[model samples]
Target: MSWTSFYLIVAGLLAFTMLLVCWPWLRRRNSMVQDSLTNVQIVKQRLEELEREASEGVISEHDRRQASDELKLALVDETSLQKEGSRTGVLPLSVGAIAALLVGIIVYFNVNQLDKVARVQHAIDALPRLSEQLAAGKSEQFNTEDVRDLALAIRQRLRGSPEDARGWMFLGRLWMSLGQDVQAIEAIERALAIDPQSTATRISYAQALMVTGEAAKFQRAQEVLQGLLSENPENDNLALMMAVVSAQLGDADTTRQYYEQIKNKLPENNDMLTQLAGRLAELENQIQDVPQGSELDTTATPGFTIEVSIAEELKSKLPEQGFLIVFAQDANSDNRMPAAVVKMPLQNFPVKVTLTTDNAMLPSYSLAQLEQARLVARISTDADVAPSPGDLEGELNAKVVAGQTSSHTIIISKERK
Candidate 1:
């Protein structure tokens, strides 16, 4: 159920319960007033009886007079007692009602965790709309914070409902849009595990895997694409991806076959067709008469070249055996997972390093997919890739265009500890 609906239901029940709690006291007060009136009537009746007996000569004058006096006194005492009881009852009932209300409010707030519940509810309500927008290729149209909130909500939900395959898929795409390729891969992989036969899931998984710039991942992506294409040769998207993967793997024959199928399947006026034609031309120009090698050719790939150095003041703090880790990550994404990273000895300080799909943590993400990125260089006391206490670090942010080269410099001047 929607959080808002559940909250409202609980609120309604609480109101009903409060009224029930106070209802008995309210009825008791009215009953007490009714009882007082009945007692007064009985007193009047008793006095009338006394007067009637005196008139009828059934009792002596002194006896009748004494009985009337006693009855009057009793009535006065009863009235006083009733008044005291009413006042005493009112004070306790009022205080009890107030205390009950206060307690209920406290319980409601604590039980609901109101602030957190509201935030999670907002996220759940927004995720479907955000997914629709993203699927429409309008992700760029959303505010960055909105995107972040949507992702957060999905994660919150997945925590409780981990078996939701579609949710994982959405989360995967959302991460990709945010330039969190590693997380995207992790999410997509989860979805793939849940539903291995889903073509869409497999395709997304392959795409993410291929960007890691790792040879093994690239081969896996190629295998996935080939498997899909074998089922339907005219699947244009599948064929196109196969062509790209084959090209990356330096399999000219396979690449040409898939490229030809893609062209044949797409209409002549299709924009993608034109784009594919140009890519095919570029591939032909680059691969003519070239022999395939065990190592992929990354020279033609667009990426970044980073220059790293230790600040003069901090240089002495660097340990002789420390490892210098350099990496680039999406600048716009909150995720710290690197798109590309390399490690070297601290002796390589003041070194220039190239970052591309070749250095990707996964084959599915590389500098090629980023329009902007942050460059980081760290000197770790141990060879650990993760930054640890006392690690010296530096970073610089830069704007980059995919398929192009950019340069940036970072100086290690700050200690993580």
Candidate 2:
């Protein structure tokens, strides 16, 4: 290609890119012009409302009828004037023509430039399999070459339409999956900045921060979440996530507080309530396994291992008082013998136990009992945490059958699409 030819090609490409970039603004402006025509629509709606009110005796029938008659006459007059104006010359015709011509020319040039860039992009090949791999969360699904092509596509698309919230979100996630934390943050942050009110953007941003362990930035994410919680306190998903994040941060008190708030705000059958219970159990387990002070030895096991898994259905039913500490004991003792204390978090959960067999002196519990032990939750308010609710006794018993994986499906809440 000669210099002029090369310049023309470049110009065409640039025009194409610009046209694509301006597409959103174009659509919005068009919508705005159309929306402006709805003033008449509002008047029509008001006319109908006045008629309804007059029929229902909510307003003076005379006033309603007069208002409706006036509205009908004004609307008809307006429509007739609009039609007349459309037919006859209504403004500075010469200036309006010039302005319209200029706008049309500008739009045409931008559109042409946009078309060239799109064509150039089309010439750049990509693999269909790459999209599948990306969907499957496989970073390795695309090699460096494939990544380059995909990356090019991403950059061009972003350049062409940076304000597209979904595109930004997707690119951010892709960067995260590649362990490109900084780039992911930038992309996701840009998306949020563009559409600050979008809940999906906020969630995706929070997830990116969590995955990257930007501990310092966590407070910002938490603030965003808290703001959202304040807006919709009964939002089960938000409430559950709030509790989970609290638990993860080693704030059991805060975690429990969030859970309680969620429970109070939500209905009796909120599904996220179930997740909150599981997270509560995990927090309880961690709290129990702690050695108190920070000074610890890595070399020694605490002589035993404790595994606690709760059945899904039972999770939501777990009270805030915490898990029931179960243990095999002398069936007749005043304080039942603590054969092996089983700390189970009530969430109507199935559990697993791994006792420390290192103490040869201690008698071993058979795997048969361990495996066969059924789900038993304890919150003996009189004997449970506090603020007793039941007249039940000190202990409850259940068995878990061995070699079985049992789970309860708990469907808590549903919202229509």
- TM per model? 0.47, 0.33
Candidate 2 at 77: error in angstroms? 99
The lDDT values for all models are: 0.77, 0.55
Clashes of 1: 12
Candidate 2 lowest-lDDT run of ten: 408-417
TM-score of 1: 0.47
Per-residue C-alpha lDDT of model 1 across residues 198-274, encoded as one tens digit per residue = 88888888887766544466688988987887787767788888877665554557777877877777789977566
State how far residue 17 of model 1 sits from its true place (Å).
2.2
Instruction: Go through the candidates in order and give the C-alpha RMSD of each one to the true structure.
Output: 11.8, 29.1
